[model samples]
Target: MKKAKTISLNVGIALALFAVFLVPAASATTVSIGSTIVGEGETGVVSLMVNDVTDLGGVHVNLTYDASVVNVTALTNSDFDSKPNLYKRGHGWVLLEGGQYESGLSGSVKLCDVTLEAVGKAGESSYLNLTDIDIETFTYPPTDIPIDEVINGTFTIKPVTPSAKVVINEFEQNPPGDDSGNEWIELYNNDSTSVNIGGWKLINSGGKVVTIPDDTVIAVHGYWVANWTNGSLEDSNEYITLYNATGTEIDNTLTAADGNNDERCWARYPNGIDTDSDNDWKYQTSTMGETNGVPVAPVDTTPPTTNVTAPPTLWPGKPDETTIPSGTPLPWTSEPVQLWFFRTDNSDSGTGVAYTNLSLASESVADLVNVTISNNTWTWETNLSKGKNTTVPGTVGEYFNVTISEECNATIEYYSVDKNETPRVEPKKNLTVRIRFEIPFSEVTPGTRYTANVTHDLIEPANEGKDATIVFFAETATIDSKPYYVLDINKSVGGTEMYVGINETAENFTMKRLVMKNKTGKIMDLTFNPEYTMLNYPLWVGKTWTSTINVSGTVTYANNTTIPINIITTEIEAKVTGEENLTTPYGELRCLVVETNAGILDTGLSKPITITAKYWISADEKAMIPKYQSYINGNLTEELVLK
Candidate 1:
């Protein structure tokens, strides 16, 4: 039977005590690291002790503490120094081990001694937690024995002396040039005492906190500036706070706009002036660990834009013009007089323009000017010259009050006569006609027959849109009282009409019928059937079949003349030769290629027309139609392909 172990709550110890359980609650060994108090910066020792145990052969101690508030500087096995052992130190961990004590250790043995330094803020406490341990103890060096409990400890950092007056002086959030060794925070000490700001937190508005390592200090009336331990101070808005070891909020800089500074920083006038306000701060020349100076940004280097406009002189159309307005006689006074004709040419004034007439507002000939302000205005006057250039000539009183600017533009309206008065440049008549395929095969109705132009692209580069004829025979109505398949051919432009032979679709997918009328208005009765069988199904590559077309149709002409119907039978032989991969505008398709030969047979017409064609039929069962067809005319001079 396994034994139950009672954990000591005051010791803050817990363990599983699984199948390899404790011997008994009474036999439980209480192992501990005793608590103590030490002054800030002072180093102290805590002993690892064991009680309520008769004998111990081997021991292992695993200890943990706050590496920030108190550092486990070093450890020793002073009490067990004579025992063979090993030890190591990490962030907040201390491990000690010893083995092979043949005589065994008895009750109240000191397993190890750990040294800790009170390195953080004063009045803060750190716990030296005894996390886990394993001990093999017995008089006869038994391996089955175990120690079941651990007692942790605490360290009180007692106050030693008063703190110095150290204020966050200046910080460079946006540093000049390379920030490599420049992003820093300076702490200025005004008090005569020295201060150690160890285990301090520097947290930003992002909730990112970085610790100031132990032993960071500021001397009396001096500054202690250091680069950040986590990341550089941000160039954007930043709010920073400092906290001591006990998590006490010491000081903080309110969120400030820090990105706009041009290689400068926010600083105080009198170095350590830490008032949190915009007035208490200024964008200044960054002074690292020294007195600050007034802010001075670099000289402006952007250039300016200049715009100038000069209009041509305007002359009177009907009569000789003269200037009337007069000003100070300056340079260019010897030039001929030209008047600004500001009055109406015929309605108001009898004479077109007379420059000598000062009563009309132009006082003399020297200062005459006229401003054409379609969107701009300019006045010309000569008084004196500040420089020998076009722009610097001076002007005086009685000037034209032109409010328009030089950059204003004038848009001239012009109308062009239409040579051919039509809405667009299209021909007076239809340029080219379109023979449209009225309905596709998928739209056919059941139990009907149809004739249509099945080949929509019969032009060269055969993928283009053109026209061909087809016929349909719908076996029965399949949906909404419509046939299963349909075929229609509707001329797109300027065709009077076409005679309808068979204008419906196939009965089913496997059978087909087609009839063609010879001309427009030609009558095709039920007895005038132009028989056509379109496909041989139940097919694969190398499938071959022969079919016969027996059609009797009347011949008709534009004069309303009709001839008697004659029966003619045409025989066609077809073979699914092979398969091919074809790419169309729709997409890629795997199609079976069929070669067919058809003409008037032994019972057919006297002048028989024979056609040999290769048809590319899509392999998809749902889309069993010919995607392309290629053939040659009777003369074989021209090749035809339909897509």
Candidate 2:
């Protein structure tokens, strides 16, 4: 029986030991220092966290960091009801201890919060090393709890980039009263810390500058108002700009024109909002030193009425007048002219006109002169002189002296009345007459007399009734020392009657002078120094020529101002390309196709003008008349056809 009892006791003891070996051990709590990212010159919070903890009564943590990167600002308990005791060692390390007098904290609780400030530059990091950590359970004498994990943290300093810390917030350009003492400008600082705006500048669009006084400091998110006494602001078309102490442009407001309402002001809708555009601003009532109000509609919608006073109108060689009709040409003179204008609002109580917009445009017309041939006549005259060498015609004789007078070149044909005999003249007399005819046809002065001696066979007694017949052929006439094959019968310019004669030679045709008479009995005479060549005669296929013309004169304006005009026209090319037949008012005629390109420059014009002209010329009349003509100036084209 004793041996059985011993065996039972041994078995029971072995079972008890086996049972104790099967039970699991408790898990250790984790204490970690939380990581964070903070901006430079900004504050951030770091937490001491306890994970998977139960029955926690007290905690103590020691953290270390690079002294140059961050600094501990303050410490506060988070999970515990009592505040933690914090001890900071310079800027490098910190120690925090906290405990609960009542029930201990449980799992996943924050011990305390550590406030830290980033003191280093951007892109710098500081390691938060958990050098020492201790945790206890809820017991009479705080039983120590095992901490298996102590996680370290880091503090990364990042750059703080704000769009604009200082901005132009609001302004009142047009006020209810005089703008000189009522205008004001407001500035705002949107930074996290105070900013010194000493030595800054504020400028208006009207060239008024105001410098800020010394030692001027603006608190964070603060405002500064500049009164009108500092600087003047225009009621309309105004803008303000702000610059830093270093003369760097920090902010500028959009150009604000006449709101037409004096009661409104220009301001940023959301205070201190800057988008750098006009869309960020609104027109509202004055909100000086306060938040802006909602935008309101304008009270006056009608535009102001205006009246313009012009200078005196005095045409050249005419009496002065008080007014000139609209569309009258104004003279561009040497002396400056003054024009006054008055503006008034439609309603007396409505918003007055802030400003008036005056724009000026100038238009000028070039003097154009055109010459055309109206009539081309060939004349033939017959005369007889006999017996004596006299100037009058008489009975038949052997020798006769005749005086022939003609404006142009003339050819005399003399023959016996009887066709049976041939006539002969003295050699010395014929040679003298032929030598006199050698002068240029154009140089032949009009109204000049010439003496011609003719000798013929004596007429028989039976043919006494027959006389020697002398015939003269005149192909052209001369007027004013210029030879003209055609005369101007009916001439007009711009539907006004005028006279334009064309002078020509066998080689080319030229325009010499044109005379015009206006309705007011004013005469305008224009003479070309080097006569303008209209055509190179003897037209054929593939013929080309070029010429230059200069027009210099003085034109008198309605304002009694005389302006000297100098115009130079350069013909780049003129070519006769081909031949064509055209039906015209005169008849169907064969014409030569002429193309001309020219550039014209005037002293009064801003730029040179180019012209391309096409003409269908009738080469038969020797006058070079065009049946069809077209002129192209820039994008405008004009055509003229024979009537």
Candidate 3:
């Protein structure tokens, strides 16, 4: 029985040993490095992570990469409690090992982080490969932990491209007179930032290459011209190509016939426009250093014809009458008097009237006018024939005394009559008046037709009978398939006459162009692309709109200095602020207040400028006028107010 029992115990122990051997070990761990992208010359970090680790007490990792693409900059152990026991780096590989001093770590953890710098050219890539990795568990005798997966990372270098765009703008393959010494190519920088084009090459189809000189730079929205005196361009079928400093093709023109000396050349219509197709090039009049467009012939010199069509010989209380009689005297009233004139320029299929200017010549009384003053107010009363006098009563101690007298003309004087009072006069309040009586008329220029509507108030109430004559010129034009009556107002400032062109439409009013002519005959024409909108129809408060304006043209100064104005894009935001009664030179009328803010991208300036303009628009009169304008640039401010 004892032998049998001992044999049974041995069998039980054998079964127990088999059961211990059947137990499963821990799960496999995973080591990996994630992929990353970095720009050339930029730095990036890659983490060496471990997952599903069990009793991980020590670790050894080795990584390799393409040295030409990226270089390891730093290596730091993260998961271990103590510093790495061994850390080393070579040309293309790195090795690190570390261990925990107190207890073994379980579960997932970060082993190390490797920082690298992208050193290769754009589009190059490198591999982060792991090799010779070992992980051990904390025990009396350390045991190796099995790795089920190894994830490698990839590092890529991305290209860096400039934001400024440059393109071939215009070219003249054939000269109007001679081919040699005239063949030229033009390049334009279309962005607001300047670009360096040094070492750029221009290649013709005939194997001729013109290399741009060193240090060549193009300004913002500016041009660079290359003249080939040797006639490198072919007059027949040919194309030109542009290459940057690194031999990369930047732009190319389509294969087409040359200008053939037709006084025209290939140019981008809006200037600096390039779609890499034929639609961008146009064969038109050569605007070498100006905006591209068809050339305009000289304007006809014939003056328009004008005729008075309002005011009848019979005195009527109505102000809008077209006729009274042939020679009736104007009524003596404080109400505004209306003057109307019909103008036409149909002769010779005339180029519409350009502008109109109406002048208030003189107000004359047929009999002597006497003035009487009372309580700081004055009145005119006729006494003697062919003589006039005006007076303004002064406050005893505050205001200066104003007086005027004339036999047939008027002379004004200011003085103080009270000895105890020191007369005070405002700067703009001191007035001088000189009047001539005879009707004077002179024809300054010839025209075809003219039409105008003017209203004036004769408030002086001098002699009862007064005669006044109105003189003006009017013109018309068609723009963008729309009929526009062009009214030009020339404001002279510092030897420069600024012509503001207002194009009135039935629905709204806009400004089409601005011409600044100096006394030296040099002119600068600034055209608003898409016509700047001054007012919009259905005017109401809180109405808002936005527009983008491109201003382009040429400027010539009085000193003969010329500047080619490249395309300047401005963003405009407009809103109807409110409505108010506006008092203008014409009269007091209800007007809608429109405020506009314009952000202009000015070339050669570090930042964009802002121009704020406020306008008063009379819906009933169909008049839009600027009330105030302010411009703010870097360190500069300008403000203008209409008086």
Model number with the top lDDT: 3
Candidate 3: clashing residue pairs, number? 20
TM per prediction: 0.23, 0.23, 0.26
Per model, how many backbone clashes are there? 36, 0, 20
Clashing pairs in model 2, backbone N/Cα/C closer than 3 A? none
User: Which sequence of candidate numbers ranks them by lDDT, best first?
Assistant: 3, 2, 1
| Model 1, span 1-643: residue lDDT tens | 1223333542334344442365555657788888888887998888878777675666766565655678776556644534523244444455566655346666687766767888787888766665435676544535645557777788889875544556666777767665555677776776777878888777877887778889887778787776865666677788677787779887666566666535577666666555556566666777877877544443322211111111223222322233312221211111222222222112221221111011111222222222221111233332211111111100111121222122211111111111111211111110010111111233233223222233322222242243442333332323223333434332332111212223335421322322223334433221212323444543456667776666444434346565544566666678878877765534676677767776533332234445555656664433344343434244331122223
Candidate 3 residues 1-643, lDDT tens each? Answer: 9999999999999999999999977677799998889998999998888889877888877676777788888767588886442245544556667688889988887887878899899888876877657788877589988889999899999865445678878888887887888888888887778889999999988878899999999888888998875455888787889999999998888775764677788888667777767988888777776657533554444444432333342245545434333233443322223233333444453443322222111333323323321123322221222221121111111211122233222212222111111322211111112222111111212122222211111111231122221111245555556544444432222111222233334455565654534345545566667776655655666768776789776655435666666788776788888877766555676666787776656564344545565666554332334243323432222222223
Flag the better candidate by TM-score, 2 or 3: 3
Task: State the C-alpha lDDT per candidate.
Answer: 0.47, 0.54, 0.57
Output the better candidate (1/2) by TM-score.
Answer: 2
Number of the candidate with higher lDDT, 2 or 3: 3
Cα lDDT, model 3, residue 628: 35
